[model samples]
Target: MIPWDLIKGGMRHHISEHMIICRPVSENTYFVLRLTLSYLSTQLTWEEM
Candidate 1:
């Protein structure tokens, strides 16, 4: 039989790894979107901003 702690630790490690892999791509897109929105807002009027 396997230890419960080992299973939990493995699952935790896997979730952290997935987050590490996915977080950067998401963050990059979010940052770019925010920048684009800010730029457009500056170029446009306050109503759209």
Candidate 2:
């Protein structure tokens, strides 16, 4: 199984920005997407940032 720490770290650093931009599409989907994106962003790098 994937390590939770790694997964959470990735989302906070990488995917949060992407989800913030996607907010206008749909509220319900946006919420879910934001959660997933935020979760993935934490594991990204400066290049990804």
Candidate 3:
């Protein structure tokens, strides 16, 4: 969970680093990343908890 928060916070940094390295990424990979990030970004309300 700690690592996940770090990645979420440094999203732009990671994107820039990836671009600098010019690594090829698949669409499926990005989709999964966005999906997980979105899912994690939700705030849990007391009622939900």
lDDT, candidate 3, equals 0.70
- TM-score: model 1 vs. ground truth: 0.46
Q: Can you list the residue pairs that collide in candidate 3?
A: none
TM-scores for candidates 1 onward, in order: 0.46, 0.33, 0.36
Instruction: Report per-prediction Cα RMSD to one decimal.
Output: 10.2, 12.3, 7.8
Which residue segments of model 2 deviate by more than 4 Å?
A: 1-25, 45-49
Error (Å) of candidate 1 at residue 26 is 0.4
lDDT of 1 by residue, 1-49 (tens): 8799999999999876875687978867777899999988887886566
Sorted on lDDT, best first, the list reads 1, 2, 3
Best by lDDT: 1
Per-residue lDDT for 1-49 in model 2, tens only?
8799988899876666665575545655867887888777765654486
lDDT at position 37, candidate 2: 86
Best by TM-score: 1
**What's the alpha carbon RMSD for model 2?**
12.3
**Candidate 2 TM-score, C-alpha based:** 0.33
- For residues 1-49, write the lDDT of model 3, one tens digit per residue: 3798788769978776775577546645776798887777654443377
**What do the candidate models score in CA lDDT, each in turn?**
0.83, 0.71, 0.70
